[model samples]
Target: MIPDADPSADQAPALAEQAPLTERGARTRARILAAAREVFEERGYPETRVAHITRHARVAYGSFYTYFPSKEAVFLEVADLLFQTMIQLDLVPSDGYEPATLIRRANRAYYASYRRNAKMMAIIEQVATFNVAFQEMRRKHRAGAVARSAKAIERWQRAGLVDTALDAEMAARALAAMVDHSLYLWFVQGDDVPDTERLLDTLDTLTLRALGLRP
Candidate 1:
């Protein structure tokens, strides 16, 4: 069965789980999901309907219900797929690396990925504004990254690289917020963004400075 919203909110209504699908059934389900993503991208969430998804998939209307109970169920899976792409980018080994190099690499990776997925990212941001489940999922995803960064900072402190007196979690969250919202403004809010290399360089410098390191 496909995962609908990998990290679901407690208050969110659950979709009914389907039984294991055969190969052909799986292919059909995948087609429906792909169609749903296209519909969502073309029309945004509020304007998309189950009929639109099935019509785009070129499947009978009943085929949509056979796999997904509703448009929201399918959209949740689409959102989770987008979230997974982001998770793969930031979770990496940090040991035995220079802070400046790692910071630059991270900013470059994040900025490039955001640029590629800006359209879908914009849609997700819009969804999060009104959808509690989407909001919770976004929050949990950021929290996981912040927690990972805090662990890395703690390791840096042990090596006498970063300030030992600072609260690692708090410091990590501050840096995360700085990067996250700045990217949001440029990528989603139509703010003026510098050239790619210049933007990444500034992000790298600012992140290093925040961590009390020379850029």
Candidate 2:
């Protein structure tokens, strides 16, 4: 018979004691975030204030500060949450797919999220110009995003789909620039997005060819 497992091995009485408080903190944070989104969407980032968020959240100003230091901090947290929400949608391509297939999936993921979170997306665009801190935050976020894309391109090269000689970082940055510009154009087009599927397919072709992959 197997020896009895040690009872203390999995025991975390300290954590058990703190679990409720941790959960409550998370709930309070979520409430503030929800309130912030509404406040920002309604008043625009420049006009929105921390007091508005606290009032909307039905929490005291001190409670709001206890959870987040400032309105900008809360907005950044919203940005972080939006990024995480998109990640949970599995925008990243799987290793099993060819580069083109991966590109299609990634594009679809972006377009879908862009539509679903249009309000937050608009706020993001506004803040990128309206807030200096948000601009820096976006820069850092883009760097990380591009780094991941570069690694993915390197993986594709190893898989024999992309040219091994192409500089992964350069290709990734170019692709990021291209996708970003395209999204800007799409945003300008608004509800009149004609032939979106064709657009994404064309983007895949263009990006793949840019990476020295045959279309």
**Candidate maximizing TM-score:** 1
lDDT of 1 by residue, 1-215 (tens): 00111122232222335699999999999999888888888899999988888999999999998888778778877886666566455423555557676777677677777777787888898898898867776676676667667877787778898889989889888887787788889888988875767776777777777778755
**Can you give the lDDT of residue 115 in candidate 1?**
78
TM-score of model 1 vs. true structure: 0.86
The lDDT values for all models are 0.73, 0.69
- For candidate 2, the clash count comes to 0
Query: Which pairs of residues collide in model 2?
Result: none
Off by over 4 Å in 1: 1-18, 90-93
Error (Å) of candidate 1 at residue 46 is: 0.4
Q: What stretches of model 2 exceed 4 Å from their correct place?
A: 1-22, 87-93, 188-192
TM-score of each: 0.86, 0.80
Error of 2 at 168 (Å): 1.2
